[model samples]
Target: MKNEPIYLDQEENELLNEIENGEWVSNPLSPQERQAYQNNAKYTKSLQEKRQTTIRFSVSDLAVIKAKSKEMGIGYQNLIQALVHNYAVGKIKLEA
Candidate 1:
């Protein structure tokens, strides 16, 4: 005999279908999962060291960069270095 369609109240049925289809995924990480990810990230980030360097830029460009740095909550020098490094590694795209 064919099985009867499961009659679930709205809330139960809504999630029930997703559970069966394997599409239901947790939106946020649990505390243990979050801690594991954080530990791995901390180690990865710690593997790098800061190096000091200097370069010249146009006055207006420096002013704009400083303003952008303030907006991004980082120092102007750090922002410039990040932009240069990202460009060098091809992680960031520059539009013509």
Candidate 2:
């Protein structure tokens, strides 16, 4: 069969052959390096940061929201932001 380069180069091919023949290679990371990595990882919680958001809603509110959005014609979230900001800052009130 013709010599073919499927994935590995010469050094990688040698390493694969050594592994296939049951030879052992030294660990790339020492115990201290492994410990440092474990310490830096987020084990118990997800990462959190501020971000822009979008949401979908029901048809009636969506129609009103979309028509108002077209009149303004900027980012659709801007109207949502305005309404939420006004309500949150006590300019609007919830009926129920």
Candidate 3:
């Protein structure tokens, strides 16, 4: 049996060429640093997990949201998600 050659995208091909040309250097991390990185990755992955919920919106507000999202070249749900995430992370503040 023979194995077929794998094709790589432009970025992947460039990385492979650099590796083959000895342009890459290895810098091993310490055990503590590695563990810290692993933990951080796990936390980041958890933060990215999504759950679905329902919310009610007025027809006019929803229409405006859809129009704005379309103008921005994104879905209204994505715009809402970004807005919620920004507010949750304190990037968008509500004046009270």
Q: What TM-score does structure 3 among the candidates reach?
A: 0.53
User: Could you give me the TM-score of model 1 versus the true structure?
Assistant: 0.44
Runs of candidate 2 with Cα error greater than 4 angstroms are: 1-50
**Which is the winner by lDDT between candidate 1 and candidate 3?**
3
Tens digits of lDDT, candidate 2, 38-61: 776754233333366767788899
Report the Cα lDDT for residue 59, model 3.
99
Q: Could you estimate the TM-score for every candidate?
A: 0.44, 0.39, 0.53
Q: Which digits, one per residue and each the tens of the lDDT, describe model 3 over residues 50-72?
A: 99999999999999999999999
In what order do the candidates fall by TM-score, top score first?
3, 1, 2
Q: After best superposition, candidate 2 residue 15: deviation in angstroms?
A: 75
Estimate the lDDT of model 1: 0.90
Distance (Å) between predicted and true CA of 33, model 3? 13
Q: Least lDDT summed over 10 consecutive residues: which range in candidate 2?
A: 42-51
Per-residue lDDT for 27 in model 2?
Answer: 72
Q: Candidate 3: where is the Cα deviation over 4 Å?
A: 1-44
